[model samples]
Target: MAPMYDHPGEHAADDPIRLLAVRDTPLSLDEVHRAVGDAAAGGTALFVGTVRNHDGGADVAGLGYSAHPSAEAELRRVAEKVVANRPVRALAAVHRVGELGVGDVAVIVAVSCPHRAEAFDACRMLIDDLKHSVPIWKHQRFSDGTDEWVGAC
Candidate 1:
């Protein structure tokens, strides 16, 4: 199927895929859903990672994220891998940094494909690979005035 948006000089019929990478102040599930929506797409899958109030029974006050400047480049590489491994009609990934309160979205991924199976597979692969390979790190702040640096936890 054709992509909903096409590049200049490229026919919509010729462009079968679309991809986006963003760094947002506050992430939204609706934004992710919109990025992957296309009439030609038969399936869409999304993953959202959020901050929880407690970890291992610890009172989590908040969390902070840090990333190398090359983090966006690395995320783009993962997105490219998803496109290479599946027939993705549209895909988007965004990760937020800085301080976040409990229940805030940390990351979001959306993928659309021609079939449900590939959509699920690609969505999972995108999140898994991103968590494993991305340079972003999180610092968990506990209510006890303690902090821990977690590597993709």
Candidate 2:
């Protein structure tokens, strides 16, 4: 499919793939980055969220992610918003669902822009908005044999 936006000096179809998905499989940073690879872009920014071993002063043994049916669609909306607001060359993001262990990559996002500052700002906006607005929930398993869910569907 063609890129959703075409700016001056940049053909919409000339951009790389724009990925948006929520899946049970492992996510690859390289894959997301590659999707946003654009020769005309002077800067590419990436963000990776890993499963850490702790949350809320509790030791986390592992975690699982659950997504609402609209999670993927919401992700696409978020990406499109970033694209419309920024001079992005290309963008991609993937979020891993199902169970995850400590150090596992939970989410990966990449954005390419014509300038470094724009790339950084857009990348940050994409991730921050995604975390706050996406309908993805986190279930944390504590070392003390308890669990709780974070975020609403």
Give RMSD to native, each candidate. 5.1, 4.8
TM-score of each: 0.85, 0.88
Q: Write the per-residue lDDT of candidate 1 for residues 1-153, one digit (tens) a residue.
A: 121222222324444334344354787678678767778789999999999999878999999988777777777788888888898888877888888999999988879899999899999999999899888888999999999999963
* 14: Cα error in model 1, Å: 6.1
Q: Candidate 2, residues 1-153: lDDT per residue as tens digits?
A: 122222223334754437777878887777777778888899999999999999879999999999888887788788889988999988887888899999999998889999999999999999998998989999999999999999932
User: Which pairs clash inside model 1?
Assistant: none
Query: All models: lDDT?
Result: 0.78, 0.82
Among all candidates shown, the one with the greatest lDDT: 2
Which residue ranges in model 1 land beyond 4 Å of their true spot?
1-19, 22-24
